[model samples]
Target: MLQSSDYDPLTAAMRPPPGETQEQREEREAAEAEALEVSNRIDAEIKASKQAMKRQKKPIRVLVLGQSMSGKTTTIKNFQMIYAQKSWAEERSSWHIVICFNLVRNVNTIADTLNEETTDSILTGRRSSLTEWHRSVLFRLSPLRRIENDLKAFLGAGSSESVEIHHPNRPNTSDGLRDSPSAQQISPPEDAKRPQEFCIWSSSGWKSILNQVKTRSAQGKESQVPRMVRAVLNSCKDDIHLLWNDPVVQSLLRAKHGRLEETPGFFLNDVDRILSTDYTPGDEDIVRARLRTTGVQEYRFTLDKGTGTSRDWVMYDVATAWIPYFPDITALIFLAPVSSFNERLMENPRINRLEDTFVLWKTVCSSKILANVQLILFMNKTDILRRKLEHGYQVKDHIPEFGGNKNEFSSVLEWFRRVFRKLFTDNNSSLNRKFIAHFTNVIDTKATQHTLQAGKFSTSRSESMALRYGCFKVQAAILRNDIEEAGLM
Candidate 1:
């Protein structure tokens, strides 16, 4: 018997039969050689896999929080355009259909407004503002409504439901907002009616939907739908223009709905260019294109920072309900459309949009789980805010707390900045946290790119400082242990 310490288990297991012939011995040797080669290959693969894992950096997780149409998606697009140029270029042409849909939907919205006004006047037996000429224009432009439906269908499954806005449960007043005196003034609309707003469920994969539309548009049999849509829009172009420009339709749109010009994805002003046969969306048009997100969306990109180092970044465009789930996020980009001071959420018409943003911001700041995460507040849509101020829309009219401050853009912007900063200081419990705010018009590509670059530099500096601080703590602990070991304490 072999001693336990000296046992050769591998050799014993590989021992051949006792009556084996020379040819059988040779076969056994060959089989053993093949097995050894296979084992070596697997070991090499495992070693390579481990090396690759070691080379890969952990993904930086970012969460983008904002209410609907707050430029969250547009901001992500900017990141893609800057860092993932190849993919952005590939998807650029696919936005043509979406841009067309936006234009068509705006026209249809105008038509619907006119119909509602006309019907209400008839029911009330009031003198109608709509003339026979207006009636004729509406009749001629009816094809756009069908085109909108077809475009929605081509967009994919959840397209029908995209017309309905789902109102989330009103923000809990207990989430830091209840303490504010202004919170009492902000209430939901008495009539909580669901309005028709175009949105896609995040689960449906909107990029894939756009790609499918592009693919089908190229195929012969499936190409007719897009062609038909183009043909209808082109034919109705003149009538669409007439109706949109008509004083009666304009008055009705203004009275029933707010300025369509102020609306997200308002392309009516570019109907002539958009309806042209060779129209391709410019960067601005694509950025401004409105598609409301109904659920959480995540995006990933590999960024090379030019120092022979690259990092993977994963960004989550999340709904309010999903905020708490990402406690370990590297950063939170909160977008508040300061321009929406006078407007209400399409989902919940009762609460002022800006006020809603305030509540959301406070809630985010007060979350203990997110206390350590870097917070970046984007006071987005400053362009729209400037326009509103220029148009004489008073900030005091919507936000009483704005007081008698000058309604000028600079004053209003400063006031918003101060308010946001106060909220941040009040709610955040982290002693090491920093407050970063940027007034951004994310749709303006050049301006947004500059801001993003500055943001990246600031974040890098902060991270470097943190790393040095951690190293200092580690060195201090080691020095203390050395002193103790030396009996010098």
Candidate 2:
């Protein structure tokens, strides 16, 4: 160990000459004090400004995209829920709005992860929905707040006593005005809660007074206080309605509106219950039960819970939003059914002429997309093929070992992978090395079966499975690599 007295290279180099003058040393010390004071002040102000900026800045925007029923909604729902829960714990303020349109309800087909047979009636913009009032309430809140001060100012109040419009409007009245007979009769009781619940005027009284006014008007007599009060209330209601109809307020309302509904536990409970029912339920029974349950319209319920977290997704169908603004879309989640490609590659005329029909892929590869485009192929309905392989007969004698029913599992996977790889290469690497293809049979027993049969669904699976898995794995790894290089997470 080195002693403190032992010469240190850094200290020696920084040391001043022993013969330095007293005046020079005094000047140096004064300069050093001034420099330290300046640095300290700068640091204090910088810290204060940083804290202030953090409070003022907006939350980061994240955009998500996936094909219809490809777990897109469920993904977003899960994300929103998780964001609320975790972000709440982290003390971070975050909010989300989901826009769903053109949904078809009550189909007889098997559903994906986050689909419901019917969306909430309010979300569908239909009257008679129980949640209609709730929908209106949410839409009203944001715009009301934005124009709260304006409304209060319009109603003859200054900024000091102005309340948020969502709160009850309390009119300022002096003690003399409160004691007046006309005012006491017209003003509501103190115990009344909301403006709507408290009747400002008696309907029967108003009717009688209005009749009196009409009768007097017919006789050429002036109308009284009752007629004037009636006119004032009607004018106020019309003003409120006009505020709701304002174009800027309406646009802001649309930007802030969202719909949420609870999911039924039928599928979650019954599926788990069925799994635990007997010591030995056959694979066929399992498959049939899944098909039956999946055919139910509860697919939408999952979007709100398990897979719902990914709903930050904005479908670019409406360019009126921010979709057109961000020219660099980093990734794309493409939806193409594995069954469609397998069963209809030759039969579907549109697909048969792939060069003519694959306009979306070509567009994605164009200069606009190529700068940042990354493709994720969601191979839907893989469960259908897995079931066929499990139950469908294999080629009999004289077939190679790779053609066996068990090997067909690998073979089927290979078939899809090869096709996707070929398509990628044929299209001049639209995704370049960033192309990833994966199979998803969300409602089927196949994913579990593939996991069980293939012993973890990794090494023993086809090159295609690897390629698909590689997409996510590689992206994640690249992120980690960047983080490591930056000495972050």
Candidate 3:
């Protein structure tokens, strides 16, 4: 090492003066010029590439879907941040091609209504099935009754302060009503301001019922039929406001004729497919499932993030809920607890009698959803293993690929590959199965957040890709490796 004695400490210089190193300076300057040229060329190439991408017009559409609380929202938001409005040049921009959907709200409402004997009690009297009563009430209830009532108030037809259903436009009537000195009286508000002419156009069916009830009363022949007729008329008059308030009914009237949309993404003929395991014949689950099975088109929305912003997203929540809506999705991301998987493997004494994980997998595979599905299973809470390992518990070697004691993470990855392959892969053909399955758990608050919260359910792109792309990449590679090993690729 050079000591202070080798150089003058007071000179504040360790190298030769500028003029003494002319040739070196020239070489350094030349190198910098070359570097500048390279940078310019690189920037030009990048600009051209961006321009090409912008000129391309086709929009990419990707659909992200899964069971509730399965990280679908997180995945879509991650994608949006990475791809939405990305720019390499001022004039070129990138658009994220992802949309996410959650069926929770719609499912919850239907599930709640059908949960007991309510539908059957009101509609069918079957005590289990949703009869016409359920359908008629749901259809007839006005969605826009509040707005329609406000409109009526504006028209002065019915209100808290006034009642003017009849024609009040006759000047004679106004003159008769108002009597005061010309100087002191406000000329009983203009008669012209009152409604001109009014007509209550009753339907033929309604009129017939009303006439029958009236005739019976006039003749003093009051009986069950007449009483029922009178009750019906009274209900119609009392609830007439509600009848005109229904959006569905109003739409029907306006269209003259049309159909409503109300289908879920999946459907099953057997009620068991939707009803919980504890469901019984008289239970609400059965009733709701029946309605869902029979109902027509339903409405569902797709949610996605706005480009480049974490605080903003577009919500496509349809205001109405109906039946038999949404098309069958192609992929499923199944999420389950890590402990649950282990319990099934160990056949834990406490939860032993419950459905085992493997059996559960088989059942899910057998569901109609699997007919065109690629499952992405999230074996979440792997962190649980660290604690379990300290207790001398071991992950059984039978499913060793799913992460045993050694290299647990890699093992988990491999286990996913093998299991997915076995379920979906075909042995005799080059066709690799279209289905994919993976596992994960939602342990963090981010995972717990609802999809609709403006700033909730956010996760880092790295975290998302760790499972999303990691699963895709490894599974795809495994398939390719198998094919090549078999001389099929």
The best candidate by TM-score is 1
| Tens-digit per-residue lDDT, 1-489, candidate 3 | 778678776565534456767798777778779999999999999999999878753322222332222233333323332223231121111000000001112222333333334544556655544455445554433332333233222222322211111111111111110121121122333322321121122222112223443454569774443223223333333233333344544443323211111111111222222233332222111111111101121112122332222222221111012101322433333443343233311112212101233333444455543444344455433444444445444445223333434635556445544554454343212233334333443222233223223332222333212343222112222222222232322
- Please give, for residues 375-473, the per-residue lDDT of candidate 1 as tens digits: 777787777778778977777766778788988888888888888888988888687777766666535454333334432232233321221111111
lDDT of 3: 0.31
Off by over 4 Å in 3: 1-304, 307-327, 344-355, 363-369, 397-409, 426-441, 445-489
Candidate 3 lDDT trough over 10 residues, lowest sum:
93-102
For every candidate, C-alpha RMSD to the true structure in Å: 9.0, 26.1, 30.0
| Worst 10 contiguous positions by lDDT, candidate 2 | 96-105
As a TM-score, model 1 comes out at 0.81
Answer with 2 or 3, whichever has the higher TM-score: 2
Off-target runs (Cα >4 Å) in candidate 2 are 1-66, 78-324, 342-359, 388-409, 428-432, 443-489
